[model samples]
Target: MRDYVQTAEEAARRAGHVLRAWSSKFTVREKSRSNLVTEADEAAQAAIHDFIHGRYPHHGFCGEEGLSVAGNDSTYRWVIDPLDGTTNYVHGFPYYSVSIGLECRGEMIVGAIFDPIHDEMFLAVRGEGATLNRRPLRCSAINQLDQALVIASLPVNTDRHDEAVRRFLSVLPVAQAVQRTGSAALNLANIAAGRVDGFWSTSLKPWDMAAGILLVEEAGGRISKIDGSAFQLEVPNLLASNGLALHEQLVAALV
Candidate 1:
């Protein structure tokens, strides 16, 4: 799967380049009241799709910028988020990334995430292993929720009455700490690298969680629905942890 890994990395890097080029001059628009999309997002997605589709002309494509292409093999597809943290990029927060994952028959077989600002590349192949910048990756061994640094994803413009906010509040006192990052992809990548102990989200799309799911699994983490049920990509209610004591505790807390 060297070619798969190489192509994913190259595509992600290409998108990252496009993001950087447009960073200084991009115009922003809202996808919703507080949800932002920018010219940079579209341009980076174009760059990513062009590079990947040129290599595998028949591979289906799904991207965050409303790009959808069906190749001859419907079972083989590339899921992409050209700019995983658009708000972060817009504000120069430097926490965004380009995420790409290859799925076969609804199962992710390869995944790659690239942080252009930091020049970090994370990759994983099913049953093989996960890596960060060519070095092996493993989840942190924190076994207890009280000692974990956990993160959650709440939708933009979320308020106190939102279910997501309720979930966040429930975990606030139980886990060591609870934080929110604008980028879910980066959060997952950090989990794989043993930098973050856990992450849970009830609001994320396929592109946001697709690649990172494989990365976490390969890095020795466990993933499931917030209530510890089987996770389905179509309806994302995910809770991912280091597969130690935090998993069950998180499930109980989230429920």
Candidate 2:
């Protein structure tokens, strides 16, 4: 493994440890009417920050707990979500995870996501394909829209409910099923592992989707802005799919 990837894996695992430790013993605070954050999130971010900064002193970081430093002269940047699925975690749902990604020169290069509850780790490096616990992963081969299981995320705390509902309805006729998993990190991880056919969500932070995007691509899936444009951290909209043809059709229908 590349040094950065190795370091990321270590950081992710350590963050997972922090997450597990605080899983049920933490207090939740409302960040918004529909959003929550827990002590686990902050603790996990602190551990990741410590681990990564110890090895790569100058690398930039943008973490979910609001950890950011001065941009580095180097091209590398770390995007982290110390705890994803916070609401789920607080409610005793076991779907939360720690996501970490390294982007170099505007391209996502390494990604790792650890689901501490399940002890599952998904990892990918640019051009190296994706894996879960060292086993290679491939996206599903399903091509027909009606045979696909899709995930759609609606912005709960925003006024996008009607628009989100309209979009979901438009795609519902063509999809076999649709779900809202509440965790972009897990959504992308499942896409990479072929457990789900595709995922679409608006209103995400860079830390939430960065790692999972690289994982999906490396697992032979396609990812893009909802309008089919290339995705970037600033413009956080994303649509990841196993079947390109179906993805295009869905995008066309929504637009």
Candidate 3:
């Protein structure tokens, strides 16, 4: 497990470097109305795939940039989002990151998220707890919904855009504040680090939440579907919180 975590961290950092180098010069194309993908996203995923496949030839890989390797061993797969915040990166918003998660036999065993602009690496191994830059991390203890700071994402191109807006309206007045950070991976990492109290999103891919979800769970946070059901990687909607009393209220508000 430790080896897996180390490999993921290395891959994330290498991809982060690729992202930083191309941030200023990469060409962009629209994947959809408000969905953007840059040359850096592909390049960074290539760098990550090369590094991981070189080390673990038998392990499978699934990347957001369309790099998929069905290796000999199907039980160990790496889920990667080379650039989690392409729009933010393209606009110099500085909140983008490289997210990598290793799932072994249907369970996430190791995860790493690297924020190159801030030089922060968030890592976690199942049952071993989570950390930021090698220091232990814990979720915030804020138990009151009115005192909790929350974050969310509502991609304009998603089919659930209107539903997300309605959910946002429901949360706005009850929580301390609601923010849209454009990066679900970073939002989940923030929840793990206790930088924010909670996060929910109506649409997300496995690459967007795989790594960050492990970080939150290892850090003693809570994650579920919007209706408070168990969270599955394939499920697009999710709610993550600090495992405080406010979680129930937040879930109720989203209903």
Candidate 4:
């Protein structure tokens, strides 16, 4: 497990290098309305895939940049978001990251998220405590919503009538503070590191939450769907919090 975690970290760092090398030099392309992609994203994923696939040739690969390969006789699959905050990266906001998570038999077993700008590396293995920059990580102790600082993820082009917006408004006056950060991966990592109390999003892809989900759990936080159902990677919605009474409180507020 530690070996896999090491590999994940190496791959994430390698991708981070690629992203930094391409900063401000890559061409941007819109994936959809208000959704952006750039050459840096593709370059970073390619770097990650090449390094990981070269080391573990039989492992399956799924990346945010439309790269997919299934292992023929292996249970290991790496889900990657080489660039999690593309708009931030494109705009030189410096909040983006490279995320890599390993799944075995449909369960997340290893996770790594690396922030190039800050050089912060978050890593976790199943049943093993999580770490940030090699230091142990644990969620914040705030259990009450009224005392918590939280974040939300609203899909690009979200409007006033959207359920996401409605949920955002509902939580704004309840929590100590509510913020909308473009990067879901970092939001989850912050929850794990106890930098934030909780976070939820109804719109995410598997790669977006894969690594960060494990980090939250390993760091002694709680994770589930917004409705408090079991978490599914295939499902887009998620609620992650420092598990005291905060999980239940967030569930009620989000749903």
Which is better, 3 or 4, measured by lDDT? Answer: 4
TM-score of each: 0.98, 0.96, 0.97, 0.98
Local distance difference test values of all predictions, in order: 0.93, 0.87, 0.91, 0.93
Per-residue lDDT over 1-255 for candidate 3, one digit per residue giving the tens place of the 0 to 100 score: 777888899999999998888877999899887789998999999999999899999999988977788899999999999999888998999888899999998899999999999999999999999999999999999999899999978866656448888899899999999999888888999999999999998689999999999999999999999888999998798999998778898999999
Give the per-residue Cα lDDT of candidate 2 at 16.
93
* Per-residue lDDT of candidate 1, residues 208-234 (tens digit): 999999999999999899999899988
lDDT of 2 by residue, 19-130 (tens): 8888669998888787899898999999999999988888888887778875664688899999989988888888888999998888889999999989999999999999
Candidate 2 at 144: error in angstroms? 1.0
What's the true lDDT of residue 15 in model 2?
93
| Candidate 4, number of clashes | 0
How much is 174 displaced in model 1, in angstroms? Answer: 1.7
TM-score (C-alpha, index-matched) for candidate 3: 0.97
Q: lDDT score of model 1?
A: 0.93
Least accurate 10 contiguous residues by lDDT in model 1: 233-242
Per-residue lDDT of candidate 4, residues 1-255 (tens digit): 877998999999999999999996899889998799998999899999999888899999889989889977469899999999999898999799999999999999999999999999999999988999999999999989999999999988988899999999999999999998789999999999999999999899999999999999999999989888899999998999998898898889888
Give the root-mean-square deviation of each candidate in angstroms: 0.8, 1.4, 1.3, 0.8
**TM-score for candidate 2:** 0.96
After superposing candidate 3, which stretches have Cα over 4 Å from the reference? 158-161
